[model samples]
Target chain A: MAQGGGRVQRAAVIGCGTVGASWAALFLVHGLDVTATDPAEGAEERLRAFVEGARAQLAGFGLTGSGRLRFVPRVPEALDGAEFVQENAPETEALKRALLAEIDRLLPPQVLVASSTSALLRSAIVADCARPERVLVAHPFNPPHLVPLVEIVAGDAATAARAAAFYRGLGRRPVILRREMPGHIANRLASALYREAVNLVAEGVASVADIDAALCHGPGLRWAAMGPHMTYHLGGGAGGIAHYLAHLGPSQERRWASLGNPALTPEVQAAIVAGVAEEAAGLSVAELEARRDRALVGILKARETVAPDPAQDGTAEE
Target chain B: MAQGGGRVQRAAVIGCGTVGASWAALFLVHGLDVTATDPAEGAEERLRAFVEGARAQLAGFGLTGSGRLRFVPRVPEALDGAEFVQENAPETEALKRALLAEIDRLLPPQVLVASSTSALLRSAIVADCARPERVLVAHPFNPPHLVPLVEIVAGDAATAARAAAFYRGLGRRPVILRREMPGHIANRLASALYREAVNLVAEGVASVADIDAALCHGPGLRWAAMGPHMTYHLGGGAGGIAHYLAHLGPSQERRWASLGNPALTPEVQAAIVAGVAEEAAGLSVAELEARRDRALVGILKARETVAPDPAQDGTAEE
Candidate 1:
């Protein structure tokens, strides 16, 4: 929504994990100066290599020469002069509180700090920060350089608009959760689906590969275009959502009745591992990651053209 | 893989509703001789227009000369000599069972009769058919010609292999569920998610738009390539799924505590409608459908080079 003269220029990635590294790379590729940091030993080398791989991906998207990237030794160094901070640190209430306090302490009051924690509440993370109003959650998927979504949940109203705008400046789509809860929106939805998927595997009803296949092959692609409510609306013909619920509701209700209770027992874990291993088949973890990254790069680039900027945020993750 | 001439020649679209019509058009434009039929009155004209739109899409895919189109007025007429059948009749069991029985009475035993039912069990549909051995569920998304994945669920051993091979012949990415369930795999996974989405909307945690924005902008896009299991695997780094479950498992469990039990009460329905309507803004249902179709076409064509075959039992439909 800009005339190309002004938007986000400086960004920071806190925590230097896979998601963090991807965020740093994405920010840099979008022409923002990205300062990435972590306190772990050898974090710099790890982030450097991660950024290198992401740059190759960014280059594939014709974005390698757009901006700058740097690795810092500490959180304060990462936050220096940064307009936006994407925190990807471990999802601990204590660590996040301490980190936000430090970030707010180091940066100007207006700087937006986003927690990349996939599950923690924005309120909890910014509890001890001086300007909690400026801190929010902008959770991005791993390999953020490719995935375009930025789930922005504000700690308080003051930060919501600015946080949303800052992410928009980053060339990322951000959805604001009016209120906070565990898993926010996307991850929570994903939790529900994963729970059932795991349950199905545990019950010997389906294989992990088959379960994934059912989604990516069927509704997953449908969801890539439309969400469940809308899909049911269409399925209803002229009757719309109300009609769909009336007719198909009985069927779904019946199916729901038989749906397994999501008990994550040891037996369930074994089923998941074996099922996933079967699903992985020939692909090693590294191979799967590369494959996922490559496909994700294509998907992100493709969606940049068609993906909506509007908020209708139900992800498998939600 | 087929040896020489790796081309799809013959295909059939049974039950010419929305999904059926889309399938007919897609197959025709893909250069396969599509035998389209439905029991409903005026299905021919509807099928014709649907094929025209799909032809335009096929042209977009540079497949102008890829396939031919044909429409028949009768169920047996469509199934005659067809290599594959995409049945898109009503989802009701009585209707599906009757239709499959009729289809089985006419189609050759070698031909693959794939149902387009989104939720009905493959075995149940093929239960009373004469050549039930060749009848498998080849469920596809709304627009079959565009979405790359085809959920191929073979009820038994013989039908499974045939289903896989047939989808391969059609150039679809097929994933076989080892067994059957109420909604098969995708819908079940999605149901879990949708149930929560409905809950979240009803609970006022986030606006419907924001929930959707979280997906289209974030994890939904990543899922276009990799799945939840793989995503968490990568998130786990060197530790793999084992590490992920052990570490994040507690967090996930905690979040699950807050997940509202799904309730389709009046208040919840009103809340859902209001929230979703806000997300839709001014777009009409037709407009939404058009948008979904266009995007689906682009995604499917772009990934045409990467789709797997459906002939093998394991990878049935699309």
Candidate 2:
């Protein structure tokens, strides 16, 4: 709804689970009054703790949105005076449809509503809404506050453009999809890669630890700085993407042909679990999360040095 | 081959291409007396320049090995007193076979020879060698000195173990494959993902820039620290990888079913070229490479802060 900083003062975060809490913290850090609603027990306490945890990370990136956060138990009250709403409810189709429809009916037509659905389609989620044009899928990766991607799939061009601008203002990379697709773009690519990764483990081509190391040390390093297309473009030497398709296309096709589609049988599942155990080497999830977040902060800062924030760069061309 | 440090003092680098030059620099940085041989014109000057350029990156990693670098014009002369030989010749079977055979005849039995072939198989490449056991594939990602991954695919256990130990001593993550397949492990996984990325571009689902952003901001960051298996393990919540498989396996399969197999048509190629031009925004290939290397150095340093180097950890368990 709001183009720049002055117009959008208040934002509502529906469903204060892990994803919702992250959204709430991010909104507050972006200097928006975040009214977060979650019906779960202890949701308020958890949200507070999550926000406090995210404060250090935001500070690491030198972000201080300085907005107020208010906890509410009812959705209607949360959306009373909010200009933007980010819904992170359960993944059930019926639940998301009903919840989105209720939000659409209660919120004003001008206010935009976004659902953080990783797998669900935006069309299906907003099918029952009174004004579906304003409702879209604004899926973020896990740990929404840290990760910069926000996949925006809108029913109308104006909604997508506005949402893109809003996210850009917050220093997030919002990818607008030309059409609605399941799992959006990132998950589909990840699923494709993971399928082969599973197949390799099941086929005894490589160990789980080795497979993971292969990625993290090899292409994953490149992927951190650039995507598959850009990496290939670089791979083409000075000739760029066209040279790659012409010369290495056949080799890629051969590799694709040999790509595995292994069944995730009981045996495969056991192998993966055992492999992860060895890889973890007694490190708890919390320990791993801290390590991951530290690395993320460093990488985000590194990227910023190379490609400064669009808001700061004054080159906000989508 | 010798296990640990003192015994393996001399190393030989065959071929003076980009991969060969990087291998030369890495070996030299690990304190190996490197004798690099390449017959091409101006090979010595090019090799010296490449090594000088990599010096800053190696220094950033706190590496300073006092090893002498000698340039030789003939392969036999380079291998005369070398303990290890890393071959980086062209991918032609006839050239690799003849070159490897010559090295096998010249070097002693204890000397280990590794090929830097990415797409070609070790089995096929070493089919004509006198002693294939000592010859294996030690594929490195592009710019081998920066990226730490080296996919070791050896025919026998001892050869693979020795190669792993050598790479480990050089501060590299060498993953020993259980079985050799096309593109090995990393490239196969990359190819699987890239196929879908190409398909998305062909289908008009998203732009090239957004596709890259989705990955770099999302899974790519996680990938830089941990592999897919570990990321999914965390995604599984407190249940770890086991819980994830039981609940989310079906969803992954569904996503897999929808993965595309698009042809690398000319139109698709043109679109990528145009999109990359826009994404590049007037940055040259050399400029992008420098930015990538700088970011990589920062990420590598950040990772070291949390997970200390395995050499320092003294628990080199692959």
Which lDDT tens digits does candidate 2 get at residues A228-318? 8878877887887788889999888878888888888899999999988887878887787777778777777765222222343433323
Q: How high is the lDDT of residue B56 in model 2? A: 69
Task: Please give, for residues A179-253, the per-residue lDDT of candidate 1 as tens digits.
Answer: 777777888888877778777777777666666666665676666666667777667777667777767777666
Model 2 residue B109 lDDT score: 75
True contacts kept of each: 0.45, 0.71
In terms of docking quality, how is candidate 1 classified? acceptable
**Alpha-carbon RMSD, candidate 2:** 2.5
User: How well is each residue in B81-111 modelled by candidate 2, as lDDT tens digits?
Assistant: 8888999998888899889999998888778
Best by DockQ: 2
Runs of candidate 2 with Cα error greater than 4 angstroms are A1-5, A304-318, B1-5, B304-318
- The candidate maximizing lDDT is 2
Q: How does model 1 score on DockQ?
A: 0.42
TM-score of chain B of 2: 0.94
